[model samples]
Target chain A: MTANRPLILLTNDDGIHAEGIRYLTIAMEHVGEYWVVAPEAEQSAVGHSITLYDPIKAHEISKNGSFYGYGISGTPADSVKLAIHSLLPRVPDLVISGINNGANVGINVLYSGTVSAATEAAILGVPAMAVSLAQKKNPPFQWVVPHVERLALWLLKFGLPPGVALNVNIPAIPPEALRGYKLTRQRLAKMRESFEEREDPRGNRYYWLSGEVPIEESDDSLDATALNDGFVSITPLFYDLTAHSHLQDLATALKNLT
Target chain B: MTANRPLILLTNDDGIHAEGIRYLTIAMEHVGEYWVVAPEAEQSAVGHSITLYDPIKAHEISKNGSFYGYGISGTPADSVKLAIHSLLPRVPDLVISGINNGANVGINVLYSGTVSAATEAAILGVPAMAVSLAQKKNPPFQWVVPHVERLALWLLKFGLPPGVALNVNIPAIPPEALRGYKLTRQRLAKMRESFEEREDPRGNRYYWLSGEVPIEESDDSLDATALNDGFVSITPLFYDLTAHSHLQDLATALKNLT
Candidate 1:
């Protein structure tokens, strides 16, 4: 609600204390007055979920400077909901979610808390972006800050079209190794998620979820493909889940049921 | 993969023992040979999330008669994934998620584990449907069974287009009171979620999540609108999240950054 500068609201799937959101808050500070409201715990794969049956508590956490924020014990979407509707005094100019620990690309975005936060903001009519670094190891987020800052400035300067948000995935390499940006599509490929069944002390079996990130080579048209080749990938995502093409066929088929 | 009848795999967000899935199993049995793989506990709003960080355990739960199933300690999407990839002896011809305890309409579907389960199956190239009863109170699921059976039969016979699924919501009224069906669009309304801040016995503060569902009157083309008018609402849903219309505009806007 700052009249002096454009207000930016920040959130992440990683807990509020995670290095990702901390760095994101720093990067966004240079462009606009920002606030951080994120999950109190890691909510990595908890997609656009909200806490309907449980209590969602928010406690304000002190940051050193002008950055004010709260940590909510709920999913990433709940953090955004409480921040926008209850915590903040005024509506935000832009909502930026993450410098996520891992890349949100391809079909993985469907299950991404990082992307879901941005999508929730877009549904509420605010322009938003979800930024992630494509590294499972220690991501050089310091190197990625400049790109985030640039994108934030660009988004603020030119507001996105209605019902759209940018899903940006940066290569994990150092700044010098970056090959610039690629405006790409969210690809159809998915991670090969497999489970390992293990027996606990009681001889009962439990399954541990594990998956291999896709390493298949893809063309520049795909976000994962561009990121794999050391390019930053920005994909325009929407909240409308309708398969517009299938509408006609479905309508026709359902008519036969009558 | 049964030759005599179509094979339908059923799952729900309301856990394996919910009356919704039980009714769904009964309806599907008349149409096809079916199996249930669902969450052991209620996982409403868990979206398309998979169990990546935790160990998931599956134990067989026997329902008297041919309704044999497995209950998994995971989200609805995880149940579908485990069933299709590991548990099921053969790939099912169709996947039906829910007959959910509550309606999943408009933007709420984005946070729905019920819809997410079906979306997961569609991602893997199986025809899928998410059936929900549009009542917050005790839903008359028996009245909705014929509608479910008819739709399941139609979908199996004609087959859904690739990457598409039907999100069906039936009225809570008696079968005769039902006003027939309407193939509608996913509306653009959302639940207004609010958190009630409370203090624990130790003086620690916590917030409970609750919300007022949107009651705004929408046009007949909307799923919420149709359901409100006592009509069965069927929305064609897809897994592609791209805002295809805004791609050109966004690409042109971000071109200056390069």
Candidate 2:
């Protein structure tokens, strides 16, 4: 635990071979001593799920001609858990999940494997952040690499409070054209989703989950809006699911139940 | 859309054929019209995941020579999404997820497919509650059926606040020996986990995620403690992951990051 050279654990929901983490590892190399531990396959939308009731296999992954990190047959949460508890030589000072393939904003935060990995790290008493490039497909990871490096360095200097992790989203645009960062809240705008119905070869009716129909939003202080307007979005997130605001009212209402 | 006959959508993470869901259906039948749409395979701890890239297939399932409901090859979240958006007769009056075999308390709520299914419904503007019998194996759903019925009747009369879902955990005790229900907050106790290492037929080492070491906790109001002491724990939860308390401090700390 050298104060000068912090141990930064690197992970992603995308498979170990994904371009995002590869670029992120290259970026974090300058920030601190980076150790990579991530899923063996793409684990998008897996949330905080862990592999229980089954055996998980972790293999040492290598890139080019050298060792990369460990690739585990588990969810993003599993990767972080395994890395912190069993793999890392010592506890990491900071954990960075992603440089994800797509922006994780709005309700996506609850369903995202990228953010979940960071959440796991935070729960395990580490300063963590989940970063995402706004592009859904074929994102320019190099353009955003410096931005991630800058933010991660800042994060290493200014540690996250206990039980908190940052959900960061960068706009998918040329760095020259991009605006600066903005502190934002996760969007609560109504999103409508429908499924795509199809018949497989066996005459069975199947449905593929479709995209969200983005409802109109009048609020500009939300993460979704900030990303669309060419700003990097940083929303501090925590894992506590309790509706603290509704606690009193809920107690009063449910008192009549029994 | 009659108010008296509430249309209740039933689902679980333990798959459609799990005894928990079967008992849940029977319990809901007395409350209102019950429609069962659930995953064909066990999806415990899947969290709020929905299958996006994969095609989801659904088939009509019948129990006791009668049409039971639809079974889908999807997650608990996917089942709820498909049911509300496409499959159901109308928007369900309420969605009750579980009669799950295990408790969803503290951090488990974030990783529980049962709680996540209810959470998905709450997001889609429906009153929802996830019911878990705090028994890990062979949970007797019979004792808790009447209690669930009473709770459902109460919920029908007094609707939940918007953006809120209830995570209900009943103790795994007998009806007479059980202590009364208590409104509880999600536990924040620390848990230590270790993985068991084993070798497969091919001499490949694999690890199975093991149970948590329950650090001694003194907080009686937390869901985990309440459940342990033979009390039903109802924690109101929301999907917004923002660390509202830390937002101001975080904003001030990162102001110099740029």
Local distance difference test, candidate 1: 0.86
| Candidate 2: CAPRI quality band | high
In terms of TM-score, the best-performing candidate is 2
lDDT of 2 at A16: 88
Per-residue alpha-carbon lDDT of candidate 1 for residues A158-211, written as tens digits (9 for 90 to 100): 888887889999988878888888888888865676667789998877787666
Worst 10 residues of 2 chain B by lDDT: B209-218
- Prediction 1 TM-score vs. true: 0.94
Q: Candidate 2: lDDT of B220?
A: 89
Which residue pairs in candidate 1 collide? A56-B207
lDDT per residue for candidate 1 within B58-157, as digits (tens), equals 8888866654799999999999888887788788999999878788998888989999999999887889999999776788888878888998888878
CAPRI tier of model 1: medium
TM-score, chain B, predicted structure 2 = 0.96
